[model samples]
Target: MTKNSAWTILAVIGAIVIAWFLVNVLFSLVAFVVKLILVAIVAVIVYVVMRVFVGGRDDRR
Candidate 1:
């Protein structure tokens, strides 16, 4: 093959590799955000449950 053709192929491969890396990074960020949201939701639910179960305080002795 010619030098120009070889260069073109190399460029294409480089672009593919870069795109793959970017996609992986983006997915990881999204997963982290999702996990945070889930944790927040669970915390709120637990807080509400706790309040319902232990909401009365007797301070008259």
Candidate 2:
């Protein structure tokens, strides 16, 4: 293979690798955010349930 052709092939491979890495990183970030949101929602639900079942007593002295 010619030098120019070899360089072009290498460049294309590099671009593909970079693109793959970026896409993986983006997906990971999205997954993490989704997990965080789900946890927050669950926490809120638990808090509400506890408040409902455990009524606060008003003892003003």
RMSD of each predicted structure: 2.0, 2.1
- Cα lDDT tens digits, model 2, 1-61, are 9999999999999999999999999999999999999999999999989887775554565
**TM-scores vs. true structure, each candidate:** 0.86, 0.83
Superposition-based RMSD of candidate 2 using all C-alpha atoms, in angstroms:
2.1
Candidate 2: regions farther than 4 A off? 56-61
lDDT per residue for candidate 1 within 1-61, as digits (tens), equals 9999999999999999999999999999999999999999999999999887786464577
Task: Please list all clashing residue pairs in model 2, or write none if there are none.
Answer: none
> What C-alpha lDDT does candidate 1 achieve relative to the native structure?
0.95
The lowest-lDDT stretch of 10 consecutive residues in candidate 1 is 52-61
Taken over the whole model, the C-alpha lDDT of each candidate is 0.95, 0.94
